[model samples]
Target: MKTIQVPTREQVNEEAQALFDQLQKRLGKVPNLYATIGYSAHALQAFLQFETSLNQGAFTGKEREAVALVVSQVNGCNYCLAAQTMAAVKRGLTQEETLLIRSGRASDQKMNTIVQLAKSIAENKGKSAQNLLAQFFEAGYSEAALIELTGLVTVRIFTNYVYALTAIPVDFPAAQPLPYALQEQPQS
Candidate 1:
């Protein structure tokens, strides 16, 4: 099997270099997934723009991280699962709560709805059932929030697929493996 090389900050073009410098300043290092995108500066810039825009949207930081956790779990992307687990902690979720979110559950009713909807959207490829959509709004999310949630799911999916394709080395601390009982079985 061939390994996809993650580009070093030194190896990327000027645009990517600037982005890497910024990322390093903020995050202390360029994560391998972002570095993979750095191989195409335009792609890196576009992804950064898209992600930053979503961060400014209707979801609270914890809610957004919840969406990311459930989506990453559904997609079985360990790289994102690990990264988002850490991000979720920084956003104030207890490690146990993060694990529960990944398993499509949450102690908070509203967040449970959000995680379930994100899981369904990702597992079903954006073809989530109407009842799930209704539940999201019934839980008090606006149509605008739903739209933003969909966008967030799409962004996470992009990174999930990228990491899956590249089999990139995870740069974050390894998340605890989802217990077998918590693992979602593949739909037949």
Candidate 2:
């Protein structure tokens, strides 16, 4: 097996070095996955720009984090599951609520709608069911908000796919295993 090393702060280019400094200042450490992205400074910068743009969108931090958790879970990306689980907690979701969101359910009705839609998008490769779209709008999401939600799902999917491909060693604490019932099984 070819092992792709995670670049150290010193190993990265000047652009990635600046990003590492900023991330270290803000987050107290450069996450290993971000460091891996630093292997390509352009990609690292692009990822940061895309992520920052999504943060400025209509979805609240909690809602975005919920979507991230659901998408990560559906995609079986352990790195994102760990990172987003921590993010969900920081955004005021209880551990149980985060777990529920990862399972494609939520106690809050609006959040449940968002979670279902996010899961649908991730599972179906952005082709959500029409009824789910109806529920998303009926749950008081505007068309613009729907678009923003899709953007959030898109960004999360990018991370999920990258982490899945790289099998990057997770820097965040591991998330608890999903309940057996919530685990994705092979289709017949």
Candidate 3:
């Protein structure tokens, strides 16, 4: 297995350094994904900052994670599948729900809308079909929620695409890959 290329702390630029420090303090270590993004520290810092605020903002913690998991599932991002599965567990997501969502099979009434909307957003790249948008509204979500949903997906797309192109390693545990993802074959 190829190891993740983590820029040495000293090697990361000033912007990346601050983000790394904060992430270390918050998560105890910079995750492999974060390290990979360190190659473009400014971009990584901006993304992380946006991620932090988004996760802490409008959506409930579980909802934020749910959107992330569902988006990763839609994008067939195996690394995020593992990473988000762990995050979902930490957020107290039920094992059954997490498994279901990770597999693109969330069926609970509460999550149905967000899960579906997230998939549509990912599938359609944010111009969700009109009917799908209606479902989002019918689920009691305002246009603002949909907007937030879109923003969440925007964040994931950047990271997921980066991971795909870079074949970034997963320093975290091997998570169950999304049920039907293309084979997860991360390289150096």
Highest-TM-score candidate: 1
The predicted structure with the larger TM-score, 1 or 2, is 1
Per-residue CA lDDT of model 1 for 7-61, tens digit only, reads: 9888999999999999999999999999999999999999999999999988889
Pairs of residues clashing in candidate 2: none
Please name the candidate that would achieve the greatest lDDT relative to the true structure: 1
- lDDT value, candidate 1, whole model: 0.92
| Candidate 3 per-residue lDDT over residues 77-140, each given as its tens digit | 7778788878888998876787677554567666777777787778886667787778778878
lDDT of 2: 0.89
User: Which residue ranges in model 2 land beyond 4 Å of their true spot?
Assistant: 181-188
- Model 3 is weakest, by summed lDDT over 10 consecutive residues, at 177-186
Candidate 3: stretches off by over 4 Å:
1-4, 178-188
lDDT of 2 at 63: 90
Worst 10 residues of 1 by lDDT: 176-185
Better of 1 and 3 by TM-score: 1
Q: What is the lDDT of residue 19 in candidate 1?
A: 97
Misplaced by over 4 Å in model 1 are 184-188
Q: Worst ten-residue run, lDDT, model 2?
A: 177-186
